[model samples]
Target: MPQATKSKDGCINQLKIAENHLSGNYQEKRESYDKEEQLMIYLSKGHSPNDKYESYDEILMPIGALLNNTLNYQEKNEVIKEYGLDDEEFKERMRDMCNLGEALELEARQEESKRKDVEHVRNIIDEFHCSLEKAMDILKLTEKERQEIMPYFQA
Candidate 1:
């Protein structure tokens, strides 16, 4: 952009343009600063990820450990900072939580898969327990051969 150097009837129009440009830059910087402060606040309180978190949030480890296990939200942040997780434990716990979430998803699938298989196995065990199998075998044998059947004990 070319600079406006002419004094247009004693009016400095270029200064207004320059001021607007600087003002826009300042506003952008201020907005970014405010967002950073908000993220820091949320991290200190063990908050979950924001809807519009950016690069800094990805690198930040948001883990919290409570010594007493009974502190409220505000107090938990102080204790988490006091312990100073060194980030490794923070990352580990986050991974563990992710694993648990995956396990839960598998559990949902397991229920669908094991429905008939589990029921069939249970029915077989119940039918073989103690008297049921013994009575069936006796019925299959002749009356004279029934005396040869031995009693089975329940485990």
Candidate 2:
């Protein structure tokens, strides 16, 4: 729904299939699903990291023909579906959904806000710790006893 930013391995596998078909060098075997999945996480949206079907089918068709002519329309459909986009309309649907630049700015703002709050929080912790130390000095709480009661700070 949210432009499906996460990598879909099936889609990348389809890309790998395309690559093998194009190069005729099958030495570049498929990666394990987990490795593929991890790699996908690192790619920009839509660019499959390991392997990907070409963005265009005219490009894909030639490759498809080379791969034993094994154009299993159903399997392709399934991979396309997992991506939530068809070869016909994938790019259009992906458009305008994610603004990476704006997202980075927003993330920076949110982090800045969070950092400000955390600074205050750390100050409070420092204050409390200081106060606790002073109180402990007053009460002379032993180190073992202080550790046991650390959770009381949250309240």
> Each model's RMSD to truth, in Å?
23.3, 16.2
The TM-score of predicted model 1 comes to 0.24
**All candidates: TM-score:** 0.24, 0.23
Query: What's the true lDDT of residue 144 in model 1?
Result: 35
Model 2: per-residue Cα lDDT over 26-107, one tens digit each: 6654553333322221222333323554464433322232221122344444444555456566533323222443466688
Q: Which runs in model 1 stand beyond 4 Å of their true positions?
A: 1-86, 116-155
Output the lDDT of residue 66, model 2: 22
Q: What's the CA error at residue 13 for candidate 1, in Å?
A: 48
- Pairs of colliding residues, candidate 2: 15-52, 15-53
Worst 10 residues of 2 by lDDT: 62-71
Candidate 1 backbone collisions, by pair: none
